[model samples]
Target: MAASIDAYQREIGPTAGQGTESRDGVLSSPLERLSALHRISQSATASLDLDSMLMTVARVVRETLGCDACSVFLFDPSSDTLVLRASIGLNPGAVGRITLPLGAGITGEAALRREVVPVVDAVSHPSYVDYPLLGNQPYRSHVSAPMALRSPDRLIGVINLMTIEQRTFDSEEVAFIETAAGEIAVAIENALLYSETDAELHNRISQLSTLRQMSRLIASTLDLPQVLELVSRQAAELTRGLAVEIYKAHPDDEHPPELLSHYGAGDDVLTDRVRHQVRGMVDEVVGALGTVERSIQVSPGQRVEVMALPMLTGRRAVGAICVYSEKHLGDDPEFHGMLHAFSDSAAIAIENAELYDEARRGWQRTSALLQEMHHRVRNNLQTVAALLSMQARHASSSEATVPLYEAVGRIRSIAAIHDVLSSGSISETTVGVIAKHVTDEASITTLPPDTRISFDVDADDVWVSSREATVLALLINEFVSNAFAHGFSDRSEGRIEINARVSDDVSVVEVKDDGAGVPDGFDPGETSGLGLQIARTLTESDLDGSLSITRRPEGGTAVRVTFRSRRLPEDTIT
Candidate 1:
């Protein structure tokens, strides 16, 4: 350190002949000067915080030099100016508000020349610039030294010292201040590096958080327009851009891409040049299946940067997201990675939305066709029933009329199932609904005009497949017809009740009538009636179930059928 100080003194040329004394007639010996230099160095290297470190250095410099005021100015490369960063005696508000370009004043000249400048009378100096806002005092002497580093030598800032009395800064004092300036420069450089690293880390964490949020948001919906809008807004926020636009690529090259969504100010403010450039970028990104960037000069000394990234699903490009900003972006690999992740998520969401739309359309068409088929079938059955009815009405014998009417009843029962199926779900229906339809048809066609026959149906929300519903409807019709034909022959008033329920994965349907009981030797399995035979065959074969007929103790007959209920898949009606 001593040898370096000696070199600096020799480089500064000869000192003034007068001894080192302040306006108070106090002399500063060589030992005292060395102590002050040591103190300045310690203060500069004490902290990594730029503001606190610079302020401490400014205070120490004032005390060490026995000056009335001290201020530290840091260089801003982007604006090519020196900004007042810290001060010990100037107006507190002017610390960060004051600025000076190189060669503008005494401080700027010292920075521009990379040397120490001393003026015995600051007001009389040619380069002196007065700043009234800085709380000016009638000081006669001033010194400004540029802070510079050695290796890769670059100017960092300038340090200014002012006194309230006329003073001449000797060569030794100037050299000591220069040495202190060097220490301050090194500290500033280290602090700046720390700040940059801290900012970069914070930015990375924020990007990850934003990407996670976007992923969850886009995954919540399958609506195409909503997905596009979400992606546009998220892209703008992610890049900190002024505007964002999403373009969907057309299948044909003759047509330009469509702007699906946009966020930020409308395109009225965009120049023709920018619009053309964005179009070109979109085309490039789509063609290359990668990211593309372009910068256009919007006006004198003003430029706009645009980046377009392809939204890819697998190897195919679905669309492109374009971001516009006044600052340069997309140059960092980390930034590029974040963009790719966001674009990939957006592409997947778009693809899923489109697929869902297509599937929904196909389902609608299928439903329409099924409805038409059911309608035609119901019409054909009604025509058949009408023919049977006409035949029964024109029959010569009552026995012949009875069979025809029975056939008509059977046809109408099947048609009723189709009627309910056509109106709602094609795959399934409630047992209660089918029972209601069948009983309604029977009451209309089978009941005599003078008879008071009422049906009471109670089915507790047991759902079945369309095919099962047809079989159950047929079975119920048979039981109802039998009760009307035989059970209530001598009675003027009667009631038939149909009840269906499910228990422990087993389905049970019962039909009972308060009328004459079955004969002593009657057997369902041995019955000669065609309807009973059909019911038994269907119950055993198609339904995979058992049918039972019993005499009710209350002077009636009840028929019960049990089967293993089919398990409905997810989203199927219960």
Candidate 2:
């Protein structure tokens, strides 16, 4: 066994030593050793994975030091034991499974005393502990170094190197090993710091993601119950599956709280004892206008801790939510702050839902009252038109009948305003429908039986404020009435065309007739007729527009009006 061990050790010893020497066979200078240490440091600290980093450090150090065997052990303060983490020549299976107390073996003593242990003959050293599983031939020379990483030199772990030759390690070699130990300490500390920072960064990212999700879910709907349920579910997720309940605080403190939503675990956690305890906490939170926390024993052996946050809108407390956890969450300020943020979101959601509900109800009431007012106004206008018709029948003169007919036409024009409003929203009205109704109504009232008049209306469906639509309708009525009465009076048959369009942010209406042209040199503002005067007044004063009459080249008159198109604001009336 000893001969075979010699052969095995010699094979590995030379192969490992090759990493530390130049091809020229000169001993490695101090500069070369320092360069090797730099390379080893880079490889060891390259990964944040501590296990892999420590393994790389062990392998690199053994090869750099020209040793046949190496082992790395980490100290666990909780267990008070040094655990073998990585090794080269020792039983590979012993790594991670073998543990030694703080002062049990040479590695342990080195860790306990924060010093180096060197043995020329491991079999003769009183501090050596035998591992029968790690081959029969004992390595003759050994060196152990404790890894210290702080000012007081905190011992974190130990590294051991073994050789087959019964030779004492010179001071220079021992110093090199110590240098390697320093590199290992820095690598281990860097990996642990990186691991902690990565964990914290990931946790913050997850929290931000949860906040975004909660905002989306809460803003998705105006339904009160659905919002509460979503808040409960999100609160549960934020607390890592803790039981959550949302309660709406009644305006009267005497009234018991109304449960809005509950999620996670079950109701058994909310037994009578727990419910009563949580109620008191909630009241205190609402009364104090802040958060409250307490722990309670629900059953003989079961205890639940709760954190309650008041949902506040401005300065008023609207409701509160309780998070129940098996572990105490009161002492954690981070968790408390998270709960407060969630509660604020819930409050805004509740306030918005309530406002929406109130607005809907108010709109319904206002709509009903407006409909009734429009119905009464339309009936009164129709009654006035009917009275004028009766009076026109009673009079047997053309002059009397003409004025009565014009009066009836004007009344019908005003009635058309209410007709449009009653059918849809009162805030906005369409111009096309009013134009068609007025033209059709005027043709019926003004055209004589002997004179066949064809009335055609072409108008775009332009939307405008209701006040603007009424003015435009009156102007349309006067223009269409004049076209029939005077423009086509001399002809036995004629055609009247009304065209309305929207262009360049302006509304254009053109009324043309195929009849005798306007009297030569006659001006619209100077016309002695009331109908022409009314049309001009409406166009300039109310509609903020201009009116012009030009004789068509085809022996007719064309009346054109242009006005700025006033459009309603989006989502205001619709």
Candidate 3:
């Protein structure tokens, strides 16, 4: 017996001598609780490492309370379960390997209720659970104290202290253990906060590195297919996506473009049902003004997130890219920004590839080729207009359907410029002809059937390049559409007038509407809606022109845009 006591003292200190007077005296002293408290507080303050602190806490609580064993179980919010993080006096192997559901046993109950449960004899207690896998130590009584943070009782874990002999725990002993549990709770919260911040920082750094790689890929190759494949694969890796698919609308094809390349999990990444859904998402992005995100359910309870971005060459969408993943990254602003950055680079690469392909075909074919290109572009725009019409038909509200109608009108206006080029008039295309086409299309597509609206185009035949004609056409489209949609809201009749002529080596175009004028304080210089914003941007940036809106003297609004004249080769194609 003396030999056994001496061995035990060597293990934990002299105070651990079993059944000795010194051991009993030390356990009974008031200073023992204070000393144990001081030790736990010191460890908590010294270390931000949760596992080491939990182990120290379990050991100290078992020795101070004179118990046979101790275990600390931490709560997992994601799984809604308690995991045993630290233990002593049982199988050490089982320390970090066991879990119990909420309210499953005495420990679980304490954690769920945020209270201390003292079992005088757990062997006879109905709420006690026996797990032989935790080891063969037979504990008769135990106390489970919930470790929680205050101000709403956020439970972090439960601390269980057990004794071999059956005994009732006094209030003083329970109080001391609870104090230690409090310190453990603080340590757990601190560790979790630090871990989350560190992880976010790591992801941010990784995303920036991935974006840099994508930009390099863009600058490295004019091989559109190869660049598309590499960029898609890199994007999938950055977002941990299942796959990425790039689809480009070919101008020559009447139908929408096929998927040019798929990276990551291959074609099997999208099933039949998912493919149909993805096609619709891609179409919307190509038809709309900017990127769109959606959640698609690939299977009964499994959802895949998709980001559809249009590949634009200035104002026209040439194609779109779709990034797919099991997890949704739409809510993350940083990730969204990264998607836009990649989309911009992808657009530049696609445009460069198209130009290179055209150049390789020889400049001798440039005249016929440019004309053919314009015809193809016109066809693509008509296809977009058809899609928008279909979407507007199925839309649930006027607000939703209105944008589709506006987009269709804008697409057709650009198409009108191509229409004239396809007629063997590429350069020196009259702005008057483009304005007449835009006004006619907007009246047919936007104005109400019963509302009588007439369009008048009166101007000198001021000629500009196809690119210049495109910008002017879109400006007239937005102006006419806005006048028809917003200006005639209370009237049953209105007239839109388009006037263009040359002034001081500049083409000055004015669109006047005989409907109710804009609001008293409305500023056309600071327009906010998508349509007006597009018009304002094209005038200032694309046309190098200035736009202004003023109330007509005869109860209406008039908008005028003025820009310097510029000319390009009749056979130029970009």
Question: What are the per-residue Cα lDDT tens digits for candidate 2 across 432-542?
Answer: 777887877786776776778787777756667777777877877887777778877777788878788876779888888888888766678777888888888888988
**Candidate 1 regions off by >4 Å?**
1-47, 59-70, 89-91, 118-143, 161-170, 214-219, 269-277, 296-303, 455-460, 496-528, 537-540, 545-574
lDDT of 1 by residue, 1-574 (tens): 3343234334433333223345332225778767877899899889888899998998778766777668899999899899999876566678789999998889999999999999888999999898876654455688999998888889899999977567888777887788888888998899888889888888888888878877786668888888878888888888899899888888787877778888985655367667777877788888899998888777777777888899999888888998888878957987898999998888888888888778878888887799789888999999999999999999999999988888888899999998987889887888899888988888777766676888888894888888899999899989988888889877788998888889887999999999897876568998888999999999999999999999998879989999986647543322
Q: Better model by lDDT, 1 or 3?
A: 1
lDDT of 3 by residue, 157-195 (tens): 898977656667767767777888897788778877877
Global lDDT for candidate 1? 0.83
Which of the numbered candidates is closest to the native, going by highest TM-score? 1
Each model's C-alpha lDDT?
0.83, 0.78, 0.78
Candidate 3 accuracy as lDDT: 0.78
